[model samples]
Target: MLRFENVSKVYDDGFQAVKSISFEIQQGEFLVLIGPSGSGKTTTMKMINRMEPHTSGTIYIDGKDNNTYNASELRRSIGYVIQQIGLFPHYTIEKNIAIVPQLKGWNPKEIKARVDELLELVGLNPEVFANRYPKELSGGQQQRIGIARALASNPDIILMDEPFSALDPITRDQLQGELITLHKKLNKTIVFVTHDMDEALKMGDRIAIMKDGKLLQLDTPEKLLHEPAHGFVEEFIGKHRIIQNPELMPVIDIMSETVVTSLPQRSPEKALALIRQRKITNLIVVDEENKLLGIVSAYDVIKQLNDIQTIDEVLLPAEPFLFDSATAKDAIIMMDESPYGMIPVVDERKKVVGLVTRGSLLSAMSSQWTDSEVAE
Candidate 1:
């Protein structure tokens, strides 16, 4: 629930780092700010915590002006994790994590419990690591401590400024996955800054692309991948990326929108005739509102044609279905689990919008290899 309205930042020396960018982040949304060097992504993130104050325009946090709160109080209320793993080397792990809650006047017992809970939350054993200093832990472990410290006060928002950029590649990847899992578990509003596009795509719910201190586009990863709003944005996200990585392609993009459907109340005779006419094995059955009911197979219809009154009697559960937001990778993984080798793609309201069939999945996957061959 953060909103930035025409926000700009100018330094004393006269250079502007952020140029009147306007955007909003919804509650529990993981928004990633990304761009090349001098693109103002990092500056935009820092402005959220007032690490670097803007020269003009307004930044509202939960509908209140960020400037309305005391600077220290505001900063303390927002969790911040940086690339350097800024843990006090002398402080024990427990003490490092207790800093924020202590400042907020939490009692020692509550602080100790919070410290232990957070250590476990970040995948560390408090019993083993609580008394240890930062020097005793590995880089990844230290980063976890940094995260634990940031969450010590249980802030509603967390600002991660390339927090995993300094780690080894393997560790960076692991931490990225862990952060994604953590975000889903905690459901906190996260504003992450990264220069890596792949990282941005993999981790961000919505990505904000910036250039020359201006906000170019702020959209979902799927939208950003398929529909680059600007020439620079398209160039920044390589045109070949989607072709090379089918996982990046949203299912809605490649799915067949012309799904064969029938009413669940239809008699088995009519359902069988419809399937035969369409030369299909299964038919997606929906209610009056077009909400997905289930699928009825032709074999089942014919076998039970006389026994069943309505097609709903033989309708199969719509398991392993994909939502419109799912990517090709999701459909691919769930394909084997689908009874009829097809998955219905539904909207947020569970209304069937499209269908991803085995053939469509193969075609989408084949395109990647074809593109690679052409490139070669």
Candidate 2:
């Protein structure tokens, strides 16, 4: 765990990067610091390792003041990864990763083991990459090695400063996926710094929004997207954030139960009647036991206007299903794959519970829109 109390920094040139800020980071929490350049995100993270001492206020690492430990000793316990992917050109990949272990006086065999463990952990094959120097590897490979190096000592804390910013879009995507997988497995208390809001939302367990050298808000990704604290935060969070947050609108929140019915037969007349009654383009159908059967669409019914039978005549099978608590974001993904106007929600028993529509999700988010008259 880490804590910062009333921390600030003012340079000799009269530039201030951070103002008095206080916050606590829980153990194993992936906290992201996000804001525009010069927002003091980098300065705040550096203060944790004592690389840049705070001009005022005290920082505690696991309850003890950070300043209490020797600078080098304190750094050894904190792993850092940066945009440049800094690596010693003279050292082999294995030697680069083993630097921290060697500094701690680990035996050669132990350090080698640590290097091997980290290489495989970061998705690199030690047998192939161990002997390669920094120049011998591609940019992404070098960055992966840097990560392995940082973890060599098994640090409880890891700081990442735009670690994937330098890579191509495809590589960046690949690495972000890898980092998510790695973080879940390692469970280190991570402090990630990024200027990109989308990246922050995807990676951060909670985001700390900063502006003008001060903390604006700290909340879960859902809260930040749904409710911006002030005009400053609204400006930083971007214009379409509300529309983008389908995760906050769960399917259970706005489902209509009265409109759903069970039927195995098909009838255009009945489907049209149901549409007119419910004021919807479709209706849900299920088995006698309440398990999901399929959906009856007005479009399909209208296509067969002369047909008359059970609703199954126009009913289209619902592709894949989700539970009630999977989050609105998950729904958006399913919808995108098939462009569903609405999707049925099923319970643990595979029985239809309700439904969620695109309009419902957007309207739920739109309710929190900020007044345009407010200042940023």
Candidate 3:
């Protein structure tokens, strides 16, 4: 829906903040701009609606040069959200949200309804918040109101500049998930800016990594992680490369380094709860010495619930089944046959090594496929 054609930005002082960069953003694609502090991502984004004019070349919104359209007309059709939110302190949330719709000459009834709908979409109770002023709301709530105001115009594209960067980590993650869900519903073309890698991976349809005044690499998260374009790209990704290890077989190789939660020998109820809580169907059986003895399955718990009040009845017989050095392909097949979502990785001694899951294995396989295509 948008295109940048060999665009460059040079300041009066002769600093080139954005070089001759070019890329296409498909309709409804969540394109993320990721890089360090001095990178040109913000500059590139501002040029879209001529917030900052390009020094040379063109920015085409739907195949027409941005310069050809009047600034007011162009901006009215686009949604914008920033890290600071920039809401009017004196205006009520409803009034703030109603700004664009009213400017667009929407009917009074329509504007009111839209305010309610957008507030609800952002998890705010319209009845309570519609009359509240910006100062009365929390920072996150104000940010949401800013987004509601952006969507009020029903724009075809949205420009978000570090919208969630000011929030706490947990709140940031929660909002990221909320944005991902909203994108599926709204399907508006989005240009997002962030330095957080996981956010780029989770939300970006394609990530465009930038350096000082230049575009570095534009690729899917899987491709970016598995097949970095250069040493710079590799260094940019950093320890996140550990997440894309295709050769690491079995779950044990990549399980969280923190101590595993253990199931008490006599707690059948705890075992059953753990199965659902961990989203895993199997529980590792261990003794007082912190040694792996056996494993328990949910089926085993349900089957002998009447005869046993404890996990001893469901505990593995003998050494139990061992999953040794299986490739991702082998693991997928084994998981398909067993009731467990994944089997524990073990060595020749049948000792616990690591863990893998059906979902994680599938993610690995996808990275392998995309990386192969990237190689070719």
Steric clash count of candidate 1: 0
Q: Which portions of model 3 miss their true places by more than 4 Å? A: 239-248, 257-376
Supply the global lDDT for candidate 3.
Answer: 0.76
The lDDT for every candidate, in the order shown, is 0.85, 0.78, 0.76
**Which 10 consecutive positions of candidate 3 have the poorest summed lDDT?**
252-261
Question: TM-score per candidate, in order?
Answer: 0.69, 0.69, 0.70
Instruction: Compose the digit string of candidate 2's lDDT tens values, residues 17-111.
Output: 89999999999999999999888999999899988888888899999999899999999989999999889999899888988888889999898
Q: Tens-digit lDDT track for model 1 on 161-246?
A: 99989886545655776787789789999999998877887678899999999999999876876778999887787644344355
**Over all chains combined, what TM-score does candidate 3 have?**
0.70
* Model 1 stretches astray by more than 4 angstroms: 240-376
| Lowest lDDT 10-residue stretch of candidate 2 | 358-367
Give the alpha carbon lDDT tens digit for every residue of 136-179 in model 3: 98777788898889899899999999999997543454466567
Of 2 and 3, the candidate ahead on TM-score is: 3
